[model samples]
Target: MTLKYALPVIALVASAAVSAEEYQAFVGLNADHYRASGDSETNWKLDGTYFFDKKVTLGPLDQFEYINKVTNVSASFRREFDTNITRIGGEYFAENGLVVSAAHTRASGDYVNEVGLGYLVSNNFIVRVNAVKPEDESTDFMFSASYNHQLQGNDYVGFTAYADDEFDYFGISSKYFASLGEGRFIAAGITLDDNDGSSDWSAEADYYFSKMTSVGLTYNKADSYSLNAKHFFSQNWAVEARFASNTDDSTLKTYSLGVTGQF
Candidate 1:
């Protein structure tokens, strides 16, 4: 609309062209949006990942290959009610000509493995398949497809709808970054999720004190408030911790800690 916002959009376009090289490993966690009915929630996760690049080597015919393993645990608690989860999965990424991937995931209690896929368009757009399997209840099938669109202003909006237990959701979000003197910055954003027929709104902001450390705060319908802190050991490694408390007339609170690294 205005130059103030146009400049940021141009910057994103410039940064988007750089093709990412081989990816190895990464891990991180947060404790926001921790509840289902707009109450307080928190949990921790420990993850280990090993995988290869997803980019294709376009020749006479495109080709690529990579596989990975991941595992993590998360538990939620309140003054009384609680639900805990453990997840483990394996994935394969292959590009004999067209990119194809398959994955299996399992979570504690009743969470089951979900499967997904992607078809690339330009440098930004993609099509994804999200499938979920239930472990405790009568099998529920969610066959959904979605598109990701990056706006000229660098904002993102996506849409999705399902078949059985049918519903559609629209999400839109934009980010703002402000320099707080010296080498520090604060990034904030507001997100709206039109899930089913209800509209939920949330705003979050994080202060990056330096290259090695930062903290964040979030206010969402699910969690009244959440606080997070992160300390980076290197450009590729970091550790994080978070605590969240419910705001509604519920007793759900969570604390999570985790380490993340790229190698």
Candidate 2:
């Protein structure tokens, strides 16, 4: 479905879900604008997730202690190089740690389809594999794994790695989150990607003023940087904004705004 139609459906579903005595769901909408070298593009996305069971948390850590069944759906529309693109996707997480996902994307009369399967190795680890096929193109397989470890109360570290068969591409990233007491925390991460004979890296750091407000900065080896901030108006509603620029090309920039609701 297109984002224009999907947004109202998301709002209606979220509204209906709020009336249920026991329901866990989240819905978000985002709009982004990009400009580079006197050219511009715009994108819109609507996404949501619904949980079938209550989320279980670990003691004092604010981390998930177990996996709960859930469904995720998203639709996006974008215009790039005067061509319009649309994508729709959904995923289902089974209670038994099995995950199944599928997506379809169309752009300039061309289409692609992807399917993936994932499993939770443990509460803190997961692995996934995906197959993607584009119209008139061969299918490609991709694999990914992630792990997270809690160091102490509300502090943790995580690692992720992924690669694809057809495109000799590989990437790995690690992040650390440190609690600073009183609902405040700082996080930093670095990612490295290798494709063909080239390598690139990016790093980001974020600070949280409280559980409900935060800001972050990200920089890449290519001299591009972005700043973002998020604030919650209440326990269940939030707004976010972001700006990105490229130092190598002063005219290249991006801006985005988003709103989210959770119950």
- Candidate 2 achieves a global lDDT of 0.78
Task: List the pairs of residues colliding in candidate 1.
Answer: 27-260, 38-221, 38-222, 39-222, 40-246, 44-256, 105-113
Question: Considering summed lDDT, which 10 consecutive residues are worst modelled in model 1?
Answer: 58-67
Off by over 4 Å in 1: 1-23, 27-44, 54-85, 90-101, 107-111, 136-165, 168-186, 247-253
Q: Which stretches of candidate 2 lie over 4 Å from their true place?
A: 1-23, 37-39, 54-71, 79-83
lDDT of each: 0.51, 0.78
Tens digits of per-residue lDDT, candidate 1, 1-263, equal 99999999888657434322233455554343345555654444445555544332111011111111212222222222244454555444334312334334444444565655545443333344556666655544444444445443323444443344454655655555444545465567777767777888788887877645788989987667778888867656677777776667445566666666655
Going through the candidates in the order shown, the clash numbers are 7, 0
